[model samples]
Target: MHNSIERTPIRAHLTDHMVIVNAQAVETGPTRRPAAVLIWSTTDQKIAFSDPKGNLLFEGKAALVAPEVIRRLRTTDSTFFSLNFEPGNRHFLPLSRLVARQDFMPLKFDRFSELSDELQSRFELADYKGIEELSDELALTLLPRTNAKHLRDERIDLLLPLLESNQPPELNSLAQMLHLSKDRLSHLFADDIGMPLRSYVLWRRYRRALLALQSGEKIATVAHRVGFYDHAQMSRTFLTLFGYSPSILKCPKFIRISGIQSN
Candidate 1:
C-alpha cells in the first residue's frame, strides 16, 4: 500500500477579525501562532499537537490554543477545521477567557461534530455566505452569550488608519498625533489591541498583500504596493504569518478563498 497522504485543496473564508479554514491531512511544524485558534477534526479522527521539542502536548478531537504558542500539528489522514480569531476580535476576549492564559485547552466537540458535514458540503459548493453563517453559529455554540462589547479606544482607532497606508507614519509621529508620549502610546495600544503596535503594523501590511494577491496581481507588484521591501521580504513575512510559503498560491486548484477583505 502507498504510504503517502492524499491532500486536497485548502478552503478558507477570511474576514477582518476571523478566518475559517478546512483542510485534509495537512501538517505544520512547530511555529508560533499569531492569533488564538480553535481546531477540530471533521472525520472524528484524532489530531496531535506537540511542543517545539516534539513532546506530546495533546491528542484529541478538538483544542483551543492561545496566541503565540509554539506548537506542531499532526493531522495525518484526518480532515480538520480551524477558526482563527485575531487579537482585537470581539470574540477573542471571551475565547481567551476559556484558555485562562494557558497554551492549550481541550474542547468538547459535540457541536462541531454535529455541523461538520454541513460545513464541509458548503465549502465544496462554494457557498461562502452560508459558510460564514454556519461558522458563526459554531462559534456561538462554543462560546455562549458572546455578544460582548467591542474594544474601543479613540487613540488606537486613530492609529489604525495611519497603518493602512503604504508608507505608514513612524511610531514617534503617531504618538505625537495622539498627543501622548511614545511609551504611553505603546502601552495603551498593547492593552487595547492585545498585541504590540509593531506586530500589528506588520500584520496589516501582510493582510494588504493578501488582498492584492487575491486580485491576481504579481508578487513583486503586490510586495511593492503593500510596503514590503521586496518579493523576498514579503515571502518571508507570509511564511511567518502562515506556516506555508506564499508560493502555494501558484496552485490555485488546491486553494479556495472567499470573503477576504481589508481591515
Candidate 2:
C-alpha cells in the first residue's frame, strides 16, 4: 500500500524551548523503529509524550516513548503511533534542562480541549497526510503562543535566520550575526528557546538526515551532507540526542524517529 507523502514540516526553531514536528503515515510498516526524542523536564525530570493515536491504529489516545526509550526497554518488536512535544514554561513546567530520557516529569496539553468542539468530535482523523497543514499552523502559531513569555519570543527570533538558511548554520556565526557571544547565546538560547543552542543544531542535523534518507541517499552520505564528520558520528549523535540509531529510519518516513530533545 502507498500513502501520499508530503515533505516533512519545516524544522521549527522555537523561542519557547518547545519542540514540534508534523508528519503523517499509516501505522503499519516494516520494523518501524527509528530515532526517538529524549524529553527531559527541566523542572521535574520526567516528561511525557502526547498519546499515540489515530483511527488508523487503535482507539482514543495513548502515550509512548520511542526508539531510545523502547530500546532501553530491551524489546524490539513493539510498535506504536507517536507525535512529539516537549515544552517548558515557568508558570507551567518551569523546566531547566532539555534532554533525552531525562527522567523529568511527563507533561501533556489538553488534547481536544485546545481544539474547537467541532474538530474535537472528529475521532478518526486518519493520518498526518490529512492534518499536516493544520498542524503546521498550530506549531507555528498556537504552540508558541501557548506560553506567553518574552524569552520564548526571543528564541523564535534567534531561529529566524537559521530557518532562512539553505544549509546548516554555524551557531557561532549565527551568534555573531545576532551580535551575542556564544556564552551569552547559550544563556539566551535556554532562556528564550527553552533548549540549548547545541541541541537545536542536532535537531536540524537530524531533519536533514531524514530528508536524505527519504531521497534514497545512504545514511553515511546523508550524515556527511548534514555536517557530521561521518555516519558513525551521526549515528552516535542520533543515539545520544534522539534515542535511536541512524540506521533505523527509512526514506521519508521520519515519523518512525520521534521527539525533540533539548540539550
Candidate 3:
C-alpha cells in the first residue's frame, strides 16, 4: 500500500457549501475531519480504509464517512475523488441521515457512475461552472429525492451571518439576540444546522482561513482576520481538522485551488 502523500498535482474546488478534491493517487494516514466526507474511486477500483492499528474498516468503491470518524485511506494507482460537506450546508443534513450515526457507510456505484465520470472530466478541464452544477446533482443523487427538502429555521437564519462575520458573537450574545436561553439556542441550532453552534462557528473560521490562504494571504494575517488568536493556533486547528499542516499551501506544486464563481 502507498504510504506517502501523492506527489502529482491534485485539483481542489471550493465553495461555501462543499469542497471537491480530485487526485490520481492518495495515501493518507489516520485523519478525523470536522465535516462529513464522501470518497470514491473514479476508476471503479476498490479503496481500502483501515483504522490506525491496521484493522480493516471498509473496502469499497465508495464510502460516506461521518464527521470525526478516524480512518486512513490506501489505494493503488486509481483516480480518486472526495466531496466534503460543511455542517451547515443544505445538503449536509440529508447526507448525515444516510450515515445515521454510523462511522462510515458504503455506497453503491451504479447510482453515481455516470455523474462521477462527468464530474471527473470537468475537473480535469478546470471547468468551474460545470463542476459546480454536477456537484449539486451528485449530492442530490445520493439523497432520497422524496425527502430532500430545504431545512430552514428563521432563528438559525438570523444567526448565520453573524457567525460568519469577522467578529462572531459569543454564545451568550447570540442567545440574547435570539431571545432564548443558551441551552435552548444550542439545541435548536443542532436540530436545524445538523451540528452544534460552536462546531459550526469553528468550521466557518476554518473555511474563511482556507479561502484566504488559497488566495495567497499570509498565514498570520489570515489567522487574525478569521478570529484565531495566532498563526500557531490556526495551524494546529488545520492539522487536526484537515490532517495537513497549513504550511503545505506554500508549495504550489502539491495542489491547485479554485473557488466557484458567484452567480
Candidate 4:
C-alpha cells in the first residue's frame, strides 16, 4: 500500500497564540504528534488514534487529540484543517474545555461548512492579525466581570510578554515585586489561570522549543535557549508532552501573527 501523501499545498497561520494549518491528504499515513490538536475538516476525514503497537483507540472526522498521542490517519482527498493550541493559555476557552476528556474527542457540527469558509479565507490571505483582534474582543466579552480585582492583582495581561520571554521571571521574585506572599501568588495563579505557575513555565518553554525547532535550530541549541538542562532533558520533555521525540518531528511552515503588522 502506498503511503498517503499530503497532496494539497499546506499553509499555516498564527493567531491568538494558536497555529492553524490547512492541508489536504491524498491517502493514509502514520504520524506522531507532540501537542494537543483540534481538527475541523471540510469533509469527514477518516482519522484514528492507536497505541504504539497500533491498537485502534478512536476514529472519526473531527477529533480533539491530547498531547503525546500517536495517531494514524486514513482518508481520501479532503480539506483537513487543524489548530495547535499553546498549552497553559486560557484564552483558548472553547478548545480548553475538551482537554479534560480523552486524547481524542470526535465532533460533528452541521455549521462546519460556514465556519470553514471563513477560516479558510483568513488563512489563505494570512489575516492573522485580524483574527487576533477578534479573538481579543471575544475574550474581553467573555471575561468574568466579578474578577476585576483578580485581573488587577494578577496582571497576567501585562506579564504575558514577560512570561513568554526566554528568561521568564521567577514566581518568587514576581511575588516579592508584587508584594504578594508566595502562597497568595500561587493561589492567584491557580485561581485565575487554572494551572500552576511551574506548569505554565514548562508549557512556555515547550512552546518556545517548538518554535525554535521550526526555525531550523539544532536540538541542543533549542534546549539550551529554552532553559532545559540539555538536549536529553528537552527530548524527554518533548516525548512526554508530544508523544514523539523531536528527531521525528517535521516542523510545518507558518506565518506568525505577531510578525504581521496590523492593518
Instruction: State each model's CA lDDT, in order.
Output: 0.76, 0.40, 0.78, 0.58
By summed lDDT, the worst window of 10 consecutive residues in model 3 runs over 1-10
Candidate 3: residue 84 lDDT (0-100): 89
lDDT of 2 by residue, 1-263 (tens): 12312433222222232333322222222222222232211121222232223112212222233332322211111221223433233322221222234432233434323442322232134333333333334333323345544445555475654742326567787778778788887787766544566665665665556545545668877777777778888877666554445665553334332222222
TM per prediction: 0.85, 0.49, 0.88, 0.68
lDDT-superior candidate, 1 or 3: 3
Which of 3 and 4 is the better model by TM-score? 3
Ranking by lDDT: 3, 1, 4, 2
**Candidate 3, superposed: residue stretches over 4 Å from native:** 1-6, 148-150, 260-263
Clash list (residue pairs), candidate 4: 34-242, 68-242, 68-243
On lDDT, the stronger of 2 and 4 is 4
Expressed as tens digits, the lDDT of each residue in 1-263 for candidate 3 is 34334466667788777888887666666777766788888776888888879899999998888877888878777878888887777888788778867778988877666677788778778787888777777777778769758668899988887887767889999999999999999999998887788888877787777767766778898889888889998888887776666777545676677784311
Residue ranges of candidate 2 with Cα displaced over 4 Å: 1-80, 86-158, 163-171, 241-243, 251-263
- Residue 31 of model 2, lDDT score: 25
TM-score, cand. 3: 0.88
lDDT string, candidate 1, 42-69, tens digits: 7768888887678998899998888877
The RMSD of every model to the true structure, in order and in angstroms, is: 3.2, 10.4, 2.8, 5.7
Error of 3 at 188 (Å): 1.0
**Model 4 TM:** 0.68
lDDT of 2 at 195: 54
- For candidate 1, what is the lDDT? 0.76
